[model samples]
Target: MLPVEIKSILEKRAKDGWVPEHEAKEILKIAGVPLPKSAFAATRQQALEKAEEIGFPVAAKVVSVKIVHKSDVGGVEINIKDEKSLEKVWERFEKLEAFEGMVIDAMTPGMELFLGARDDEQFGPVVLLGLGGTAVEIYQDIAIRMAPLEKEDVLSMVRELKGARLITGYRGKPSVNLDALAKAVIAFSRLAMDMAGAFSSIDINPLMATPDGCAAVDARIIL
Candidate 1:
């Protein structure tokens, strides 16, 4: 059963055919996917307040249903360590077309990775794991499996990545907890299955994989 909040979001945006980053993250949160502390701010003052509440060194991105690739359009600002920097970002973001507000999140350091799922016409739901961040397409290192993935299936997907060594701790870096990552993946798969027809696709880029666990740093849902 879809949560009332999620159902309401879907119903409201049904005609838009998409969900903004802030709302999409809410859906992922309900599915038990780990996420960085975040809040949506509709004004500069609110952004500052949320940033301070979440603590300094945060990332802010424009929230708009019309905008898909935020970075490409300069709608993203990261490593904001002070209120001044956040205000600057807010000024720039407000100028962008269709700008709604901003989703501010605490900065999380970890190995960048990707988790995504799409409702395939033939396959039903398909989940993907890969090297993420902005270079996801350039690397093209990904593994895919049908929905409702098991623990073993999720582990295998991780192993299949060409950059698998990175996750296992390469060059003396801390190793990410595969068990915890598997839990996140399984939860995401469940979300895919549960929202099968409710959405067209979902993307969790830069799903930060850390020694302790994983977090979805950014996400998108096409309704």
Candidate 2:
């Protein structure tokens, strides 16, 4: 079942027809997907407190319903290790249009992966997996499957990727936990099935795949 808070966020954002990143993360958490510790703050003091609570060396992004490409608008800051830097980033984000708040979250380290779903007239909901990061567009290495995937389907999809070798340890890099990744994929597929027809598209980009598990570090839901 969808959490009441998540349902409320979806409903409110539906008026605008899109769920902001922070709210999208909250909804994904319900699917048992891992996420970095995070908090939302609407004021400078609140941002500082939340940042402190979340710890040093964190990242911050603007939480605006109107702002889609946050980085383009200078609404994102990373490697924030002290109150001074956090304060500065907060001030910068406050300058953006429709500035709602800031999301302060831990800096999760790992190899990036992508997971997404979109409503398809013929397929119902289609799930996508790929090598994620700023280069996802450049690389264009991805695989797809229909929603509600079984374990075998998920495994096959992963192996089909051009970057599949990366997950099994490439060169000196350690292999990521495939079991954990599989679980995350299954959870995302279930979420797609459950929320089918409600969203035009859902994107979980750069799902940080660490030695332990994958974390949905960023997300978006278009209604």
Candidate 3:
């Protein structure tokens, strides 16, 4: 059964064919997916408050239903070290068309990775893992498995990646916690299966993997 809050969001956006990034993250949180600390603010003051609450050196992005690729339109501002920078971001973002508010999140550092799920017509729900960030396309290294993945399945997907060594630690860099990552993947897969009919696809880019654990940095859900 879907959580009442998630069901409410889906019903409200049923006609839109997609869930906004902030709301998508909310759904992921409810599904037990780890995510960076974040909050939605509809005003500059609120943005500032949320930023302070989450601490400095955060990332703030414009939230709007019409804007899918935020960075393309200068809707993303990262490494906001203080209130002044956040205010500046607010002033600029407010000028954009269809501006709704801002989603302020703590800046997380780690190896970038991608996790996604799609409702495949022939195979039902499927999950994918890959090298993330801007190089995801350039690397073209990924692994996929059907939804409801077990811990072993998640580990296997990680191993199948050509850049799997990156996760296991490379050149003096510390290795990420594979156990935590597997738990996250299992949760994401379960979410995919739970929302199979309501969503067409789900993407979590830059799933930050660190020695401590993993966290979703950004996400999108298409209905």
Candidate 4:
């Protein structure tokens, strides 16, 4: 059964809906996917409060129904170390006509990766994993599998990727928590299966992974 919060979001965005970043985070949260400590703010003061609450060195990005490419529209600012910095970034985001508040997230360092799922008319659900961030398309290093994945299945999917080495302490870089990553992948697959009817596509890019765990940094759902 789907969680009530997720069901509520799906119902609200049922028609001509695209899940916003904050709401997408909530959806992912229901799957028990680890996420950066975050809060949504509708005003500069609120953004400041969230920033302070989340802690210093946070990231803020505008949450707008109209702007799909936040970075392109100058709606994103990172490493905001203090209230003053957040205020400036918030002010800049406010200038955008489509401004609709922002999501304040704690800054976490990790190797960027991707996870996504789409309902295929013929295949039902297909899950995707890949190198994320600016290199997602550039590398095209991805793996695909059917939904309702088992632990072994997700582990195989990870090994199939050329970037698989990254999670195994590639080139002396720190390795991510493989068990945590596996759990997240399993949760995502279940989410894809559960929400197949309400969503056409679900994309989570830059799902940062470190020795501690993996966190879905940004996500979107098309209804």
Candidate 5:
């Protein structure tokens, strides 16, 4: 969950129309995200400079309050190898209708999943896990349960889905860190309760699962 201190950073950046390098960091500073170093910069120029300083092949994304699907609206730009790509992508990004602002940071490789939290009328805050990307809409293979579910429950959620086999080192791919994903799910559960006043729902699609850990690639918060 976002600490009271870093929550201010979230408010500060988004208010100034600057997207924080890591929204999750702002939301998870107290508990801490696995890789906070990758989180930095609040604007395209800021991110570009940081990327140049960090070196090539970084990623950039629009931090829009209005657009729930940033990719569909053409607000996401990735594998940005150099300053030249940033220049081109930035221009295209500016033209996006839902562009409130953007975030830029170092790129990391991993598998992807959808993690969501919402305050269900009957259940209060509930967490969801599923196969993400184009398959999320097509397959609808989801598992849902009440907030503060146990680690075993997280495993149960994964096992319950037919796509759960993907995380089990499928097709010669390495198995993912389901434990870390569970922690993130728990963290978001805490966040839902903590920020109940500021938000009504959240969707963290494409939560990247890497050898080191999980990272949220995209997220949406509805107030």
Candidate 6:
């Protein structure tokens, strides 16, 4: 069974087919992710279809072999309202050497949060929860737990962050669905544990904890 919203998006994409991105981009778009408009170098016609499926107020970025984190390298554009912004960025991006091709996707909206998994030689897989923002590094507000976690463990980690009080339900929000975020965290942990040989770390920061759900806006799988 699929959520009404996600099933609709997937069906639309399935009908149109998906453009394949490098392993870097694909790692960010997991089986559980739902996007308003997410495509992997999809055709122009398919891009329009995805836009319709996901709706306006989208985002587009450059996916290249040389780069993985778009924002880190100034390859990301966000909150694209009209198609004009889309073409404008696309053209400018094409001229830029840092970018290879464009990755068009729907923009997600909500509060920012962080989750990560790291394989420790001594501890095996460990999960992390951090207070997200421009000051994530300065503040360094994060909590950690061992992997292969239960729902209860995930819940505890989320609560461990003092900032999480604001993330959960600070301003008339429905607690930002920590359960949903927790499930993603646990799954990421399991994935890290399963694929430990391939990477040293995985980070999903500024994960939007929306009223409806959560989306990993940014990710890094260090290999």
Q: Rate the local accuracy (lDDT) of all candidates.
A: 0.92, 0.86, 0.92, 0.87, 0.68, 0.64
Residue 220 in candidate 6, Cα distance off native in Å: 2.5
**How many clashes (backbone N, Cα, C below 3 Å) per candidate?**
0, 0, 0, 0, 1, 3
- lDDT for residue 130 in candidate 6, whole number 0-100: 78
After TM-score superposition, the amount by which residue 188's alpha carbon in candidate 3 deviates from its true location, in angstroms, is 0.5
lDDT of 3 by residue, 87-115 (tens): 99999999998899999999999999999
Residue pairs that clash (backbone atoms under 3 angstroms), model 3:
none
Any runs in candidate 6 off by more than 4 Å, and if so which?
Answer: 1-37, 42-53
The alpha-carbon RMSD values of the candidates against the true structure, listed in the order shown, are 0.9, 1.3, 0.9, 1.2, 3.5, 7.1
Deviation of model 6 at 120, angstroms: 1.6
Q: What are the clashing pairs of model 6?
A: 36-54, 37-105, 37-106
| Total clashing pairs in model 6 | 3
lDDT of 4 by residue, 1-223 (tens): 8889999998887663799899999999988878889899998888888888899999998988888778888888889888888888988888886778999989978989899999999988889988889668889898999998888987898899987898778777877888888899889999999887778988888799889899998888988
Window of ten residues with lowest summed lDDT in model 3: 133-142
lDDT-superior candidate, 1 or 2: 1
Decide which is better by lDDT, 1 or 6: 1
TM-score of each: 0.97, 0.96, 0.97, 0.96, 0.82, 0.78
Report the lDDT tens digits of candidate 2 across residue range 51-162: 8888999999999989876777888788898999898888888888999999988998898898889989899989998899867889988899999887788789878998
Model 6 gets an lDDT of 0.64
lDDT of 6 by residue, 1-223 (tens): 2235433443443432332233333554453433334665534454455556666777777765456546676777888787666667767666655455666667877877777777788988787877775567888889888887778887787778877777768666567776777677766677666655444676676677876777776655555
